[model samples]
Target: MKKITGIFLSMLFAVTLAACGAKAPAGEDVKEETKTEDVNDEKMTEEKKDDKTSAKTDLNVFAAASMTESLEELKAVFEEENPDLNLVFNFDSSGTLKTQIAEGADCDVFISAAKKQMDELDPNSDTKDSDITIDPDTRFDLLENEVTLAVKEDSRKDIRSFDDIKTDKVETIALGNADVPVGQYSESLLKNMGVWD
Candidate 1:
């Protein structure tokens, strides 16, 4: 994932450099010399027009809230290198983001924490039937994550694994709501353990 991210950033940097290095047409200097006053006036007008055209464009990115810290860090470097782009981020659960997209929210990029949310949005996916259309060619797995169970250091609970949660040593458990991907994973895991009833 890091390698892919590095490559993507490199490509973007190269494109930015190429655009910055572009030169004006060859005859523009000669034309400017012919009518200096008129050319200067036209130049200012053109510059102003160019400014309007080159103004920063807002690029809306909807991503899972788990990615908030990392994406925020990347945003700084990305915006610094691509001054013409202004990234507007909406960080929330993948399910929430999916709902927002389905409801016609403007989203230029979407980074889902789970495949289920993305699949639901894809018209080609067998798992869903919807009018949403996304370019399949642009979709790629950026990362893989694992679900873990943790306990406080000073806790007296005898829990050591998923099975331990079923014993009387455990009283209460905290799990995500069904609307989020992590919650779904937790539900699946608990169900498979025969303790979710």
Candidate 2:
């Protein structure tokens, strides 16, 4: 998995370089825009004059809302490491990000919060829309997060576990939206515990 993650990061950097009209070098950074002029008899070729104009100024990345802090830190490091490229982030719910990509938004990378949202963007997905297609080779599980139960830091509530949510002592319980991945997991857990009807 570490090897795969390294490969994936390399691919992302390569893509960034390609987008900025630069070829990936061996452990070297692209510091400036390169312009190649085709001189025919000491005169610049018209077709090659404006090639640098096509160099992308930004690499757009769509990420889950939960990844905002981490991605922001990465963006800073990435931009500092690759001076020629800028990373632009679009953070939102995984489902929303998936929808945006399906709608033809310009995205160089996508980091989803859930497997269902990512799977829906996969080209081989049976549940995905026919018009939406993502190369299966480019997909990988990058992170895994555990579902946790939390309460206010200073609260006097006696809630300690899932079982406590059903007790009369606990007045209120907070949960994610039913349509989201977190909520789905919570629902499944409750049902398995025989607490969900």
Candidate achieving the largest TM-score: 1
C-alpha RMSD values across all candidates: 11.7, 13.4
For each candidate, what TM-score against the reference?
A: 0.70, 0.67
TM-score of 1: 0.70
| C-alpha local distance difference test of each model | 0.75, 0.67
Poorly placed runs, candidate 1 (over 4 Å): 1-54
Ten-residue region with minimum lDDT total, candidate 2 = 1-10
**1-197 in candidate 2: lDDT tens per residue?**
00111111212211121123456465543333223222232233332333332342567788888889999888878877775566778998777888887887767778887888877777677787636556678888899967788878887876788788778866766777766667777787888978776
Best-matching candidate per lDDT: 1
Clashing pairs in 1: none
| Tens digit per residue, CA lDDT, model 1, 1-197 | 00011011111111111112234479686665556657567767776656644566778888999999999999989988987677889999999998887776777788998999988777668875446545667789999867789877888876798889888988888898898988999999999999998
Clashing pairs in 2: none
Q: What is the alpha-carbon lDDT for the whole of candidate 1?
A: 0.75
